[model samples]
Target chain A: MLIKIKWILFVTVFFMMGISEQADPLPSWNNTNTKRNIINYVENAVNEKSPYYIPEEDRIATFDNDGTLVPEKPLIQILFSIEKVKEMAESDKSLLEKQPFKAIVTGDNEYLKTANEDEVISLTLKTLTNISERQLREEVKDFVFKTTYPHLNKTIDKIVYKPQIELIKYLQKNKFKVYICSGGTVDFMRGMSKELYGIDSENVIGSSNKYSYNEATGEMILEPELNSYNDGREKAANIALIIGKAPVISVGNVGAGGDIYMLRYSQNGNKNYKTLQVLINHDDDKREFKYGEKNNISLNWADKYKWNVVSMKNDWKEIF
Target chain B: MLIKIKWILFVTVFFMMGISEQADPLPSWNNTNTKRNIINYVENAVNEKSPYYIPEEDRIATFDNDGTLVPEKPLIQILFSIEKVKEMAESDKSLLEKQPFKAIVTGDNEYLKTANEDEVISLTLKTLTNISERQLREEVKDFVFKTTYPHLNKTIDKIVYKPQIELIKYLQKNKFKVYICSGGTVDFMRGMSKELYGIDSENVIGSSNKYSYNEATGEMILEPELNSYNDGREKAANIALIIGKAPVISVGNVGAGGDIYMLRYSQNGNKNYKTLQVLINHDDDKREFKYGEKNNISLNWADKYKWNVVSMKNDWKEIF
Candidate 1:
């Protein structure tokens, strides 16, 4: 009887201990080698006893916003600018006669579709300028809240990757200061970054337009001049300028060519800094559309640099 | 006896409570109206029941670095630039033939003194350009630690106003995020901001030179182009771009006319924001040299705007 009681007690204690010890940090991630590697790296970096431990103040993580955090096939800013132009054309019919404005407002999807990425960006900027900073923010808020992602059949806020969201939380919980280093305008992302990813507006570093304070009107107005194009090597430069530190972790999707420099910069940080470069490969055709052969640059760079590639089909258990 | 014991206990508890409640937040400040008002404003700002209560995240405070934080008799950047130019002249003798380099290296202080502020600034830029970002930082660090204030006979780090330091601590304890918004270069200020003000490098926003990445050397080099001059209205613009919000409190010393726009911007923030503009009057000739009639712009603005004035002679118990 004594032996039977002791055996039952031992089994109960061990089971509870096992449950306590196996807490999932990244629940949305699958039980794969990639997930295990991420968990192991985080554990070592956060462990005080480990030689790879980074102090909390120095634990900076930067993520590319559009493709990495949310779906960008129909880019957020492009949609936002188109809607804004349409709204403005309602009041002033003559604006539709302009070059970029006409392209966006005339239901002339062909003009925008046939144009290169730079032309599309120019069209967006033309639509966004000539407004007070306050008005721009209000317009973006309205669009972000009301619009839906066509393919996903969900709201823009609901379209963020479940695994990436989990990763952000995991990094934040480990005392890392997470920043959104994006190619979009700072004012555009400032509207919904906090709502979508728990990122503060100040931590969102991005491209900017020339903004001047009007002494007569006491208003901050946005001008058409492009102050910065925060892409390619400029992303790293802006990170150094704004954040004033080398990030320990850089996360981005593979489709864009911009995030390569940022990732390489992170890898080449201080020798004592143990860095991680996570490139998300959109390979799950059934879930998220696969960009096959479109990410050759990122793939080649990853192969050369030995960067960790997170396959959407294999690593992520679910994609929103 | 029981009644007597109860009365003694009540008196003892009340005495201890009095001591705790009366602890001065700014001990380095004198018992003047300015000191009293500062305490009262902070108390109300932090009080949850008060209409002026600001949330911790929104409690941002910006301070000018030059005259406000450290003495800027010979502007901190000018002194730093001169020393850097002198050091560079040692390696490259050809640099001595340059306009600013000749003036600084030959100790022709008259050129800097006689020249207008803008001309002096132009000279400084000429001397500071064309160096790697790493080299600039290394040079700034060497100069900051070794240099001393001529008048005060103390190292630059030791010359920061004691009362201002106390005020910073008081504001920080009340959960205000302090930032140094200076007219100096971002790279130069980033070197010692952490040591001097307990401010992180990220929180130090300042003027910047255009920078480019060298692919071959893997270096970020400073180009000769002026990226942004963070002074006057430009200060407010940079604050909006970098900080992404208006500061609740703006503190600057009355010597130069640069801080006027920043103070006005803080005051013109959200209607319900409850902002405070503090202008430190350099009126103490005994402890610190008096800038008598030179700060007319700031003085006039403060008078018209009803900004709080911290009189150095009457308000502060110590200067350095």
Candidate 2:
């Protein structure tokens, strides 16, 4: 009787171990309709026998960097630009007299905030000029490592949305080649891409400035000339050029105006496989900021196009 | 006594098996100084205890596609251009009267052989125009799959140098991410990169034309605008922009004018690890073409720069 009891306990323990080994791919994601849809889509797409099955080679998933993967309440690039101006101002006092630099130096946040897109681009280019490509990368790496997200009080690498991280892992497990198609500088994103999102430098496509190689000095110098501005329709074009194939799954935050093009491109690919477009909506003001324009655009687009939109407040059980 | 003999035999077999398992990384090459240097470099770079050891993430190896990987006696793009013109002329006889089209249609091989670089580029652009990016890829795939090398009487895919193939595999075994930074179209290279060289699409950087996404038609149209010409110095710049790191090992054919820049860029990276630049020399007239200009250029450059030059006849045991 003692031997039989011990054997029964051993069998129970072994069965439980087997069950635990097959743990959830996305534990942070609540068992909501959004989660169910994603699981079903992945199952049908990856399963060999399914009609909508996609080959492992074609399993490409692209995610927007800023708002989709991590919180971008105060855009990181803007912060970096501000820091660059301040750092430059310490050495060159004449920079304080420049229009955008002057606006930033005088603490005119309102004017800087309402500054035109070209003005912001000019400021970024001005600050980053005369530095080698390697130096620029080092600077970005230092900023990413040293700075902390204002609300989270965690380093830039630590402020990633837990649910999205799980999704990236899940996609990777299913042999999906995950890429970050961000509007951020490719150089900057590449610095922390591996650390923050588990995506490699090769897989990060973003806005870029041209760099020239000086044959005489054997030096690679970064030019202020904008090679690619990876935003809006350009994002889709850049993805096509770089990745060679359109993504099967695209994830973007609703508030990011540039991501819609990439999401549409993903859905527009080969019709043999069922494509997925996930738009993350930050509606939870307590945990995250709720922006009006982007939210309105996302709601209207999702409704009209019948795309999946995850409400942060309702769909998410927790937010980090 | 029988049991003792059996135990001895078992030990002998196990010992032999262990020895066989640690076979040479590159067996196709003859036992030469070049082969030994490559083996030594890989060993030092991969061994953690070695002072020159590089991390797995930073172990990048780049190779030129055309002449370095496979024979380019009949340049691939020229052949592709000829094929495209012939295919297009079937539908529109008017194309036969066009400047480059006439030269191709009349089978004026001498004209094509002596044609300037810009003329060749123009012809290529003309042939590749007016097709969707997907259609262009399918066309190239069809061509690559169907065509055979004249000398070897084997398919183009099977005509790769055995020694180089082994080298690529050996590098991969050492945790090196090998890329094909080709002068060919990125789309065309990507189609064969995986099957031919065991490289994925993302790692195949090449010349490319602009592509526009047509929203109304829901199609991606390949525009005539040249996005990037991934050759010469542009190769190094493209590698920097795309891969975000200089490669540890750079392999190129001495005859290919564009590869020297990429090879230099690879060696110019981090100084902690010993960098390698291998220039393939087509000095064997019996096995391959011995073009005077390219051969001389490679010999001079390799000598001047102290880059390793692997002679086809002397260094390699066998060709494809």
Fraction of true interface contacts that also occur in model 1? 0.36
Q: What are the per-residue Cα lDDT tens digits for candidate 1 across B106-167?
A: 88867544443355356557777777676777777777778886677888878888888888
CA shift of B162, model 1, Å: 1.4
Each candidate's lDDT (Cα)? 0.80, 0.79
Which pairs of residues collide in candidate 2? none
Q: Compared with the true structure, what per-residue lDDT tens digits does model 1 show for residues A1-320?
A: 99999999999999987875456777788888888877888888899999889998788999998778887666778777777778889999999788678867766766533443355357556777777776777777777878987677887878889888889988888988999998888888888887778887778898888888765555567889888888888888888788777788999778767788888877874446788989988788898777734558888988898889999899988887
Models 1 onward score TM values of 0.91, 0.90
Residue B204 shift from truth in candidate 1, angstroms: 1.0
RMSD of 2: 3.4
- Tens digit of per-residue lDDT, candidate 2, span A80-104: 8888899889999999888788888
lDDT of 2: 0.79
For every candidate, give the share of true A-B contacts it also has: 0.36, 0.37
lDDT score at residue A236, model 1, on the 0-100 scale: 84
lDDT of 2 by residue, B173-242 (tens): 8899999998887877876788778887777888887778764544567777788888888889898888
Chain A TM-scores of each predicted structure, in the order given, are 0.89, 0.90
